[model samples]
Target chain A: MSQLANVLNITKAPQPSCQAQRLTASKSLSARQQQELRAILEQGLPQVAQPYLAIAEQINASPDQVLAQIALWQEQGLIKRFGLVVKHRQLGFKANAMVVWDIADEQVDAVAKLLSSCPEVSLCYRRPRRLPDWRYNLFCMIHGTDRAIVEAQIAAIVDKFALQAVNKDILFSVKAYKQQGARYTKKGNCHG
Target chain B: MDKQSRQATTPVAELTALDKRIINLLQRGLPVVERPFLEIAQQLGCHEDEVLERLNHLMTNKVLTRFGPMFDAVCLGGAFTLAALAVPEPEFERVTEQVNSFDEVAHNYRRSHDFNMWFVVGAESAEQVNNVINDIESKTGLPVLNTPKLEEFYVQLYLPA
Candidate 1:
């Protein structure tokens, strides 16, 4: 089939039937196979007609098995997201700020939920506060085209949420010496 | 291994209309199927090769660093932490090299704060993560403020390119 017809068929096509074999796939992936799959996927998908089939070939599995296994991972929350990882900095979102706020323990969860929903706040995580040095427990990253843009988004969030009473600080990034994917802890001993 | 190589990126390279649409659309994620790119092209009203060509161009120019499964460390039994070091200005470069030399250090950046340097250390397990942190402290001769994430409230970040 021509490329156009192949894709056009997908629009009206029913979703892949991988989920039909969900129960079997759940037990099929061994720890070693899981690790191997992770390693393989970290290499990124090939831009091909059958990316999953390509991956399955490497691990001695059928295409349907690969699709089913990946679907299982997504359901189990093992795969956080399965898509494009765009470089925001090159897209003009240079102003990156790690905004940390010391919201009270009782209220931190509520504040974090609200802060995270904002389109501007890209990453929001709650970390333990190191008292006397770092009192901030809530961290949110806002990347913008410049400082002003970032600051405005933050300010709007603060005003909208009434975070004035909360002690906060915005640590702007100066220089990135190294920025790469968090591949895993020690590829040498991932089997453990 | 398509390890997003460490290097300087071209500054805000020009993007065509389709390029932006692809970035925004893919942010939602590709369906797990045979010809995921083809599905994406259909959504954007373009040919599969055109979409593939644009993606290649974007990645080649370092616009899209990755285009695949983003696994969760905790779920995968992997360890990850965001640590900081308050390196004196004069020794910043030396300390950066020391901290970044470790394979565990995923990314290091100079943040404007008392603790000027911050980097994430990833390991296969919690014990290994601690070991990497200890190594960084001794090598740099600076106290490492360890701050592992306690809870991830939200993560998907979409920017209209």
Candidate 2:
């Protein structure tokens, strides 16, 4: 294995969260199934062909059943999206920023609709405002190679959109304490 | 996206308490393994098949947007950043549509502000990240302020509540 891979393998997984206490699901699950689910969530999804089948074997279920159930949940929209986690910065794109805009409340939806469509914008959300201290409501992220290019995009938005009447702020990320999506399984399984 | 768009999917009030509990549990994320759902079932003291059934039900209903691993882009040898633009009231939709089309952009949402369009961009390289920003500038005619993370204190949006 490459030196880095070897290092990664040996490094004791950052300690398991003291929060690893078993959390109860809504309806009680069978003892075997509960153990399987908890282990999966706490560790990670299996990485292999027919991963679902592998899971079934662990829990003593047929592969078809596992596949069917997963499909069902996905169709229901309980499962949002499933994609790979690309560790940013490790790839050398270190610069990161958070840009906020003050879109008129009346036009906010229309404006948000526009932003959400952009693939460059990864995460977008609306948070409660703190008045003059923070007026810009629409938020998005634009990652790039340098600050100048990033700035140019913002300037273009102002000019093209004629957003002179609103306020703006760019909050850049410095040190990422933790960056992971919600587990959607249980609590006390990891540090919050 | 904002809460409004979410409302169209399904009213949270309609979900059963058991559904809510399952949702709450999975929101944090399932185990990272070959058979995470099975593992979760075991821990929850239920049949693995049942756990999968519930998850499927929730996903199809649109109660959960996704269920998967969220990697730290920074750790993966890539560049990512967050930025927002103040879109004009009239041209908001057009500009947002344009921004959302970029392959590098993962997701974007609307906030209440003059510069109200917020989104995130991920790229295989730093240069690509910048290129995406520049592309947005020309495409949407908006100044893309690249807000590189200066100090990430803490960011965990998932709440079991």
Candidate 3:
């Protein structure tokens, strides 16, 4: 195992209760089966007539077992959402900006709620600011087909929220070095 | 090539009205059933074959990068954080290479700012996340601004095709 793996395994030692709680709350399948199912799903669900069946065949399990495990995991909130991960860049969204706002502590939640409701805003979250360097607390992303459109949207947002006095920064992506799925299983697991 | 050149060279594929509708519907999610495509076809007033064909085409053309279940890493005993490093212009490429070499570095992007190099580090625990950040700082001789998510208000991206 890699050093990272060793760290992970050591961390996993203290979380047995959490794992047990999850298992009991959603005990439709064994832990091993759940792990196998996640390993298969991390790659992606097959785009076929019987995707679950295909998954079962690959995992050497029954179709019913695979479907049941998926349903159980969804119920337990282990899976956020099973859907199409669209590549916005390929879909004509050439401009993607991570906009950060330095809002008052009392108004942060209200601002986040307003930002999340906007159609153009894809991701909205409140992150801790690093003082003496970074002071932005609320972060959201706006994607558009061009920089002009994105700027217009930002202007509209500022006008709507009366955030003219609030400090803000827009960081546009100039290049992407790596983009891929998050690895959850062990180093030599099914994910290659 | 720069951003301007890359955008100019991007292939423009003509999407029909039906294709647009399908893309919109599938983005929300697909039902977990034996014949999900059939279900989608029924909703969109189209044939299963047509739905499958358009999806296949989209994937083939790289319009839809992936289609699957997005698991919550934290729930599965993992951790992740967004970090940024401000490398001098002369050492940008070298710093990027050093940052991206780690297997834990999931996505790295060059943004328009002094803290130009922004990337996400995913590990098995919060300590591991800190370790990766520390390792990167020591390796690159630069301080990394670590900003892990304290609270997530909303996290979903739905683009109308």
DockQ, candidate 2, vs. native dimer = 0.04
Model 3: per-residue Cα lDDT over B1-161, one tens digit each = 86435644776666778888887788667898888899999999999999889988988888876777766567777788888998899999999889988888866888999999988888888898899899999999999999887666543465555
Ranking by DockQ: 3, 1, 2
Lowest-sum lDDT 10-residue window in model 1 chain B: B1-10
Q: In candidate 1, how many Å is residue A31 off?
A: 7.3
For model 3, state the Cα shift of residue A24 in Å: 5.4
- Which parts of model 2 have CA positions greater than 4 angstroms off? A1-35, A38-42, A159-164, A176-192, B1-161
Q: For residues A40-100, could you state the per-residue lDDT of candidate 1 as single tens digits?
A: 8877877676788888888877777778778877776666667776667788788889999
Error of 1 at B80 (Å): 1.4
Query: Every model's DockQ, to 2 decimals?
Result: 0.44, 0.04, 0.46
Model 3 regions more than 4 Å off: A1-30, A57-62, A180-192, B1-9, B155-158
What lDDT is reached at residue B38 by model 2?
Answer: 65
Ranking by TM-score: 3, 1, 2
Worst 10 residues of 1 chain A by lDDT: A9-18
lDDT of 1 at A129: 95
What is the TM-score (0 to 1) of candidate 3?
A: 0.84
